[model samples]
Target chain A: MSDWAQLKQALISGDGEELCRRVRQTLDQGVSAKDILNQALIPAMDVVGERMENEDMFIPEVLMAAKAMSAAVEILKPLLAADDLSAAGKVVIGTVKGDLHDIGKNLVAMMMESAGFEVKDLGVDVAPETFVAAARDNGAQLVCLSALLTTTMPMMKETVAALESSGLRDKVKVMVGGAPVTRAFAASINADGYAPDAGSAAKLAKSLVQ
Target chain B: MKSKGRRGGIYRPLTQDQVETIHDAALTILERVGFTYESGLDDLLEMLEGSGARVDREKARIAFPRSLVEAQTAKAPNRVILYGRSEDSHLDLQDDLVHLGTGGAAIKIVDPENGTARPSTLKDVYDLARLVDKLDNIHFYLRPCIPTDIPEAAYDVNVFYACFKGTRKHVMAGVNNEKSFHDVLELAALLADGMDALKARPFFSIITSFAISPLKFCTQSTRIMREANRHGIPVALSCAPMAGSTSPITMAGTLAQIHAEQLAGITVCQLTQPGAPVLYGGIPGMANLKTMGYLGGAVECGMMNAAIHQMAAHVGVPNYNSAGLSDAKIPDAQAGWEKALTIVLAAMGGSNYVHHAAGMLESMLAVAYEQFVIDDEIIGMSCKVLEGIPVDADRLALEVIESVGPGGNFMTSPHTMAHLHDEYFEGNGITDRKSRPKWEKDGAADAWARARRLVERLLSGEETPYISESLDRQIRERFEILL
Candidate 1:
């Protein structure tokens, strides 16, 4: 098989070490970093996403593939142009203040990154101001808020208001999610979109940016 | 409501020979592997050494002989009655008599209004107890949530006080230490008018989680267990060994290990005070190897717990095992099926005190108010399964069939009218059976929404404290009743 095909198979099989070695080898063979990322990594991740949506791939396998894809991307990062990165979108994500849950938020971040979005994860217990500052600094097109507690859901609303008050709300699409967050809750809080889980969150983010 | 303690050994997950083999394996484990204790439990070590156990002082491990284990297992009471303040709420745990109740020390509760979790507080404890009081199918009220809002020193008393104030059902909770155990007992005595009367019925019980998994005893809990047994207070010797992490991964292996741990605990309790009331508390769970977390709702967990009931029965003691748990974070379809599958198996296998059967969600990390209401219906249905088809002459309805011969309608028959409520399991309004149009007219509420409405109605209806005015005043006077 060709070098790109070998790299793609390594990523789909979730062999991070093998994928990174192949990325280095393909680069040595005069393959452009951007070509490797676009032709091999992104397509492989797209296949992984489709498999996940089809229920052929579960969370663990998807996560492994995401890890392998990221590892290969890390090896190609220095050679690729800045504009070549984040070809999908720039996004900021976090668990709202007073909510220390981050597992769901982290999953969304990983899935988004694997889907080619540049995710700046402002970890758990993140304040509205921190989210606003991160969105402003990153020039993010989308902001995702997560809150596992009912008490901290108000923080999600406040973060949205902060973004609006910061005059960045019109520029950024705010998406909300968590265990307790519903579509009605998202609409009530004036969020631009809502997704029940991580995979759908990534899909919604892609569509929102479009 | 049907009676609580119905005979329920209909579904034996383990055969009689399997039970014997497991029992013999447990005996071998106790005789050979032994159990390790903390260094400071000098009294416990001395007692075990005096009672025919081989104690390696340097190792702080005590190995029981087969004869000692057999003798101590025989000493445990065949019957244990966890009495409620109201006489009708008593749970008679003996033979294959089955009772299901709430059990956990979860730190979070899903808010009833908005379907999200918050740190559980003292008020949540009282409120859940009150909810359990009104739930007919939940036979007892084990403290379901921790009062995180209270100070550590005040936790035990306040939790017991809240439960006592909220429900007259037989309340059980884990104590912090020997001091807290005495304080809770004193509080129960004040409610019972004296310590002697309180001891007689012991409306409340202690769940002494004395053993850490894998043949090790926690120091403080062991002390508390000894004190509880010495006072003739009913105690459940809780030893939960996570399969693949704490105990062996195989079901039979986990059973063998937990059985030995329980036998070790029983030996200790009997040696402390001969014939002390104790329940074989075997809460065996699987480990989510991905996260190394407790997998409470697996069918294997239910099967192992059901097998534990058989092991306890073999040793001639009532068992306190777990079922009706779910990994689902919400009261959705996953939660419903997981809870139902585990609970039915545990109840059918005749677990004497099946807990974690109500209100628990998120793998015992959280409880929801609506979930409790929903689980009440689930428990009601499981109990119906335990009731089984009484295949007698009356239930066979031979004469009634003859009377309603030739395709006659039984719906209009007097026999149908007589056995209407008695025969079938009348659910508690949570299950939706309405036609499509009628359901749409009623706003199409799902089980969660229906249960939430029931919760709101029950919580708002009235404020009837289980404790009387005088008793409340007396309890407040003596104790710092935070609830």
Candidate 2:
């Protein structure tokens, strides 16, 4: 099989070592890093995202694809510039303060990664300023905030306000979600959009940036 | 020892020793903790006191002697015939019958046309009942939503009117007050022809939550229970004690308190009207510690509900419990899994009346029309498990297998055609079984969307209100019917 087809096969089957080895082999055989990324890796993730939307791919399989994709990207990160890597946009995601729930946020981050977005995941119990700082520092175009508790929901508003005060609010569109978070609550907090679950969160993030 | 449809010994949660221990603990709690009451039972307390219960009139606590508790419990029939409007639809709440149905008075629905959450109106109640009417797996119809547009004084009658117009299946709902309760009875009497006719085949039952958590009885609920008994009606004393908040934290402790509350309800129900039907209503579930809110998706809640059914079987009374609910806001994967786990546990454990078995979402705060149709299919599949593997001569099909040996196909064989329908539950209805291409061509609808399509198709068809036009007119004229 051709090198491109072999790389696609390895990525689709979620073979991280094979994907990385194939990336190295393709580069050694005189393929450019940008060609390997755009021709093979990016299109593979687009298919995975479509399958997920079709309900043929599940969360575990999507996470596995994300891991394999990340493994392949680690090999190419040194060779390619930041602008040539991902066309799925850049996103900053974090769970709000006083909420120790990480599973929902982690799922969303992984899904966004597999859907071809560059993500900066500030882990659980994140401060308001941390989100603003990371979005500004990373030049992120999308910010996704999550809170699993009703008490921590107010902290979402504070995070959005921190973005506004730090002068990055208008630069990046904000999305809020969690178990207790509603579209009305997102609107009350002046968020750009709200999603009920992780898959929808990824789709909403894509739409916001687009 | 196994009853007709209840598959036991495999799914038993409480062993005999554990059941006896819980039983003894419940009787002890009944005699010691008793029940605290506020008002409206001033006279019944006196009467029960005269009849051997130790009643403290001032502080209002009624303790039952073990002998009286046992005797009053014995007066309750092991089985009661709860009739639907048509005689063919009657339910024998006997020996762990495992009837699955809808429950909860949720005040909202996901408006079918737009898929947005909104307060449930009278039209939702009527349409849901019509859907439940055609669903074969849903055995009975309980009031699933509260009509937010109706006034409180006329709530009970109007809701029951909508339910009565929706299906001929046995309908159950809680009344607002004593006056509304009597008015509901009057409407039933009109439909059934007379008071005597209504009593002869009482098409509906009453659910009076007489027992409050932590061993107390609400006086209004107690009065309604008494009135139901006076008219010889079946009543369920729903006592939901959220564990870690209302009852003990341990599952065993929660079971003991809930069973004690059930016995207290039976003691009152039977003492007032001996031989009246009373269900062992034990809705014991746990509260999420992180939020201090009740979680219907808790696995412990399912385990406790399954265990309570065993306890009710030991006490020789029909059981009532809640299952098939989700804490998720929408009809998504979380809702599907939560409903799947709880419904299987409770149904297999032989809960006689598993209410809230359909359409409940967002921790029992809302119901969706699509969810009702979707849950109907879920329940259809769950009830399929109750039909244990038949392993006699014909089911083994040794002869057919030998004839269709080695490379021979059985799809065209006589044996395959003989028992296929009986052995298999033909699957469809919002639970997809189509090919990927077909499903995509059919609008790529999720379960929620498929269910919405089903709701639209079902609601658009002919109306099948079972009530007669004259009686319907009389009910509307005599009372303030909102629909």
TM-score of chain A, every prediction, order shown: 0.90, 0.83
Per-residue lDDT tens digits for candidate 1, residues A1-210, read 277778888998898999988888888888899999889998888777666655566566778889998888888899988878798899999999999988778978988888889989999999999999999999999999999886799999999999999999999999999877889999999999998767678888889999
C-alpha DockQ of every model: 0.05, 0.02
Model 2 vs. true fold: TM? 0.70
C-alpha lDDT values of all predictions? 0.89, 0.84
lDDT of 1 by residue, B187-294 (tens): 998888899998899998899898988999899999999999989899999999888778987899999999999999998999899999999998889876444457
Question: Which one is best on DockQ?
Answer: 1
| Pairs clashing within candidate 2 | none
lDDT of 1 at A105: 89
Give all TM-scores, in the order shown.
0.73, 0.70
**Model 1 chain B: lowest-lDDT 10 consecutive positions:** B286-295
Native-contact recovery for every candidate?
0.00, 0.00
